[model samples]
Target: MASSNNQQPSPNTHHNPLFDEFRWVIQIRHSLEEDHDDDIGIPVSIFNVPKPLQLSKPEAYVPQLIALGPYHHWRPELYEMERYKLAAARRTQKHFHSIKLPQLVEQFTKLEHKIRAHYHRYLDFSGETLSWMMAVDASFLREFLQVYAVEEEEEGKALRRLSSRMSHLVDYTGRKSAHNVILRDIMMLENQLPLFLLRKIMELQCSSTDAADEKLAKMVTSLLKELSPFKLMENFPCIDVTQHAHLLELLYCVIVPQSDEQTEDNEIEEQNDDAGAPKEGRQSYGNSGHVKQLFNSVWNVGSTLNGAPVRFIRGIIVSRPVKFVVQLPWKILTGLPGFSILKQPVEYVFSLQGGQENTKVSNPLDASVSRPPLVEEIMIPSVTELISSGVKFSPTNGDLTTIAFDVKTVTFHLPTVSLDVNSDVILRNLVAYEASAAMGPLVFTRYTELMNGIIDTEEDVRLLRERGVVLNRMKSDAQVAKLWNGMSRSVRLTRVPFLDKAIEDANKYHDGRWRVKTGRFMKRYVFGSWQVLTFVAAILLLLLTGLQAFCSVYTCSRWFGGVMNNVQKQN
Candidate 1:
């Protein structure tokens, strides 16, 4: 490549083909109409991912659409709730007549307890539990999202009219739960998530047409809010929805490249990703500065068997303001962490060229790196604690009710100091993100004394605050930031062998690292060669022994088990 220039690439133009194709993807995503029981993998709630253009397969583009949104993150969580709701519903309804509401409540409560207990059962000292958890969650959610089609034709017909209405009603209530009767009742009972969903359905059914429309829109918007982790990020306990993003990205890292022809089809892929590839390159120039919905944003670019220009786009529209940084917000991290989060927006303006193939930090538009904490880390804690401290979750039974709250002031903890977002030195090292981000907060804070090789549990990714690693990450940043401020630009942030030192191996990491692909390949070859030699030698020895046996038999010597050397060849 030619020497890089200081010039920055252009942002999204108001309207163009590549940009349009990307817009088309977003439109298709905004229009995803799914059934309440549909098993669309991603939550039907995150939106605005631009579809990718077809460089080679323009024809295939007719039949395929590109979908990129909370495909990894939000979909899985929704899927879990979907799966848990469906399964719990299934289990409860299985032996229907004999089961009473009290029994159902008791059974579901046990299940909720079980799920929590099973989740925390194994905590090893390796940080690789992240990878392991990824595998398990994917499988569990898959099973969870199987979308059990309830067999109630009459009820279904009734639900159809009311379902959309209730959706609107829930939206109208927006964070106003007390006004909604059924929802309030379920919440009071500490009822299952499915119950909450069903209550939401029931409320939608009871809503007025005009009133419900606004409410449902607001309700969908509220759900979409959770798809993003912004509101609760202010007083986060740890990394929020960031892990979910990593999980989804990791899954894409696997599924996107493995596609072949129709033969190996998993059946469900046709219903899911296959339906979403078309709308690439087809966005309308009609609407500008418009806010769109993006629930489970999916983009496909292809024609189905009959060829009706099929483009499947699914996702939720997100209206939440993007907060690119969330951990302690830098200002709270006191010393080092404070310095890391303060970079102005212009810092990341240069590398927008090719973040795709280059997963390299140098790619001006590397979108996969850090942005904010995930749901589990920040939102759940915030919501849960908010209610505990002062926000009330009233789960009532009959006339008597109980409120769940343990009010307390939350402590603010920033994710330690590191390079600012606009830092050019940091963007070029994309591969090292996983390795470095593991300790992102710690290393940024220069807390190595706390991070020495010992891993308390797999989640102990606090290596970012350690001193050695911190000083190491900053050398290049110091020069870049200073240069921008008209200080000396002579300092170079020396690239360290980060990905090389990415892992640790106490009881801390998984065995998969040493057992990587190359090692396995070489091991197979080595075993194959050894097995071949052993086989050949065995055959030769057998032949030689046969000859010896023949002589022994001929000489009337005992052999063959000398089984008398085959009874002396049947003498």
Candidate 2:
């Protein structure tokens, strides 16, 4: 009877599928809990480049010359730099006298978990491997900085000793040649050590007399300035030791520096905006009080001083619903020289510029030369199209931080931007860093977006070149246009503070019936061909001649007929 009952199929066996499902859920829950705890207070500096952003330019974000961190430490192509890394490590040991590789490895071993926490991706290397990697890479970086320091301190000493790839590194930063690919590699967000690690190494390396942090800042800034394609504005933001999270963060600070007051103002403005924010696509700028906030008062007032001008309806008016009374004759108003500048002191006093109440700190990033606030919507015509539409391009003395399009003057004031082989890698990495940063200022990204919209063809590049806005060291103008076009694919468009006004002005101009029709006419008829124009002119001339001939013949016939009739009457 017991055998018969057992053969009837055990009750638990029938419910095995349910038990397996329960076990699976339990495992998933445990994993979720473990991940949550692991993520607590993790210092997220290096991030795996998001898939969407990487699709545009994958190679740009990855290191090609040297690997700085555990992320790409053992890539086969990059294995060539391993020997250079070893050489750098040896130099580092020799410089420090007693400090050896084993001691550095020990330090790294103790700080492994903390270092690992900074990276968002799961690293496959075991504790021993990670520690060894950090030691070697950190040594390489420290020695790299030492090379720069030695070069600056004792000019020709380090130059003679540098070999192979190290020799190329020096040249890349100095002359900017084919080997300058290394410059882009080192600046990538993924290829970074924790600033704390570098700081620790600096502290160890510096003698009791030297200011380590100051020296470190100078070294980093000097290195970055050498590699950067963008011109660093004079008195550009100084690197604060307290502010940087990593090397990439340091680069970011140099690229986009904001004063403490400005940062606070931005934060307060953001909070206020968030407090009253509406649903997406329903944002009203008119009531938000930031619509005409493109340029600082300095720019508007400066533009006014130059003949191209802007007048504040605010402060000048005594009451609500301010009235502007212009009672001058049209000829006098239009032709009178310096008429706009008659009330220079009064206009300056009653300006609506933001920093009027207090003496404002000058922003190095601000446009050095001021132009009138753009009146039309931002129309980003191709460089060729803009030139065809009577817009002139002029080179600004200022850097890229001061790029402006003035509609009133019909001129685009742009800093001379260099386009070369290294430009793509440099720009792509800058864009990637900006995209990944927690609170990255989108200055470079915005500039790229603006350029992308304007440059649709090689002709645009040619126009920019003619105007001296671009210094093309690359293969072709088409490549320049293509580079800009490729950049904005993954970038989510957002409102850029200064560019909003320019964009509005451009859109208004592009969308205007007169401008569109005139452009079309020029492209279709006037600018089409000389043969077409000549043929049309000849046809008109033939028609006029035929009419003249007919009139002359008719007049003669009438005169002859009148004479005949008179003769008949006399007979």
Candidate 3:
């Protein structure tokens, strides 16, 4: 797929419709070289689920690769993939042909909301979801639901309704071709035996009556049929707490949900925006082909104390939710100003307006001329810090190791945003530079540091040598147009060689152009189904017929009158 024709996408263009395309290409390519073992098993270790490496198809994962230009070169195998994409695109064009742009946006919004909950572990689910927030391949479950299922479609007004395409994925996950070899058997070949075997096993575990809900039952059923839960019991022991727990266990169950409720109350908190923190724009499609694009609404962040203003990106979400859970991105929130449980107040300084009196203000870091610019430091107080500060803990090292306090949770109110585009459009979703490489120029360095972590001045000697390197990377073009909204004041620039304003002008036209198409089929036309085009033609014909009749009648009346007048004159 990496052939010239299927070029790798720019890291930021994650709006990709197919995140799993890359992985599928890899698997298919490997299949070419390796022998297909008909006996090879699908790995179905539910407790040991794999980590997600890529986004899935449908609306599940966005492609982060930025659009460059026409791609060169193509692998012969990629032709097959291209065909699949074409079919999908054609399907979308047809379904959306009858729906207006606004209605299309609303449909997408509903789908996004339904899946957003699934992206996270249910807040009601056991605490296990939180621990795997960053680690597990939650996409395993997502793909298991989406890939095998057929997408619903209604093209060209042909009234056909099929079951959800997602069900196939769910069904595939539960297939059990081999008794002991669960997933290994199912993934081996395209046979129905594996599916049959898995279903039998689930039937043994929980009766239909025992299921909590239809969905919960399906989840259990899929797991049972695919993995051979009955066979796996021989090698793997399952601890059924419901069977072994005593009175204390029953008491704990009653207390746990209440404790969960209390924890949630304390966990989520909303912080008002800081006066100094930069604000970004949001984009959404609106009525009549209009777009509401918010731009340049936040703060004035610059380099050196008052250096020229700079451009910076915020962050983008990587996952959508399912069920009732939502996993907010940590990278986006890192730069946002809030109560960092780990941060300490470095110092406060007063901004002098016209006063000579020394004043104390909470600026977080002092920026006055008298004091050296406050080295912006992010203080992280570990459990050790808490203990050192005499918060009272006396356990030995190994005894206290169970506490995973390295992660500090901060909750804030997230604004209501639609599903298509995110609130922070400037924050491109992909990272091209390797985290191992040295940091970039000044403005970018600070921006990255805000998302990552502070630089260590003591250990790193390269910090002193990067001033010129950073300055040389400044953007030269008028990409500033990408920043401000439609209301900004104008500026004049002398056009130059090679790089002209023509490109910008053409881009402006393309970006602003709008085209609309619509179609509808009414149940019955009281006007009697003379198609609109045919009706208009009939009206034109009727008008011509009336004009002809009027001319004939006028000619006869004048001829008769002249004849009578001649007879009277003769008499």
Q: Quick one: RMSD of model 2?
A: 16.3
lDDT of 2 by residue, 267-370 (tens): 11223333233321121112112212222333465555421111222333323432222333323332455332223222222221222233352311122112
lDDT of 1 at 505: 13
How many residue pairs clash in each candidate at the backbone level? 102, 13, 42
Candidate 1 local lDDT, residue 367: 20
lDDT of 1 by residue, 1-571 (tens): 2335435454653544334465455545643542323332322111111122122222221211111111222343234333333333344343345544344344433333222222212322122323322322322222222112122444354335333323333322233332122222111101112212222222333444444334433332333233221222222222222122222222212211222232311111112332332421111121111111111111122222221112111111122332222223323322343232212111211111112223543421112111111111111222222222333222222110011122232221222223322222112111122222221221211111112222222122222223211222334433423322321111111111121122111111221223332353345434545654465577699967876775665652332245666678888
For every candidate in turn, the CA RMSD to the true structure comes to 33.9, 16.3, 37.0
Q: Which lDDT tens digits does candidate 3 get at residues 53-85? A: 012111111212110001100234323333323
Please, what is the TM-score per model? 0.16, 0.61, 0.16
The lDDT of model 1 is 0.26
TM-score of 1: 0.16
The TM-score, computed over Cα atoms with residue i paired to residue i, of candidate 2 is: 0.61
Better of 2 and 3 by lDDT: 2
* Model 2 alpha-carbon drift over 4 Å, by segment: 1-43, 146-153, 163-165, 168-178, 208-210, 257-379, 397-401, 438-441, 510-515, 520-571
Cα-based lDDT for every prediction? 0.26, 0.60, 0.24
When summed lDDT is taken over every stretch of 10 residues in candidate 2, the lowest stretch is 280-289
Candidate 3: where is the Cα deviation over 4 Å? 1-201, 204-262, 272-571
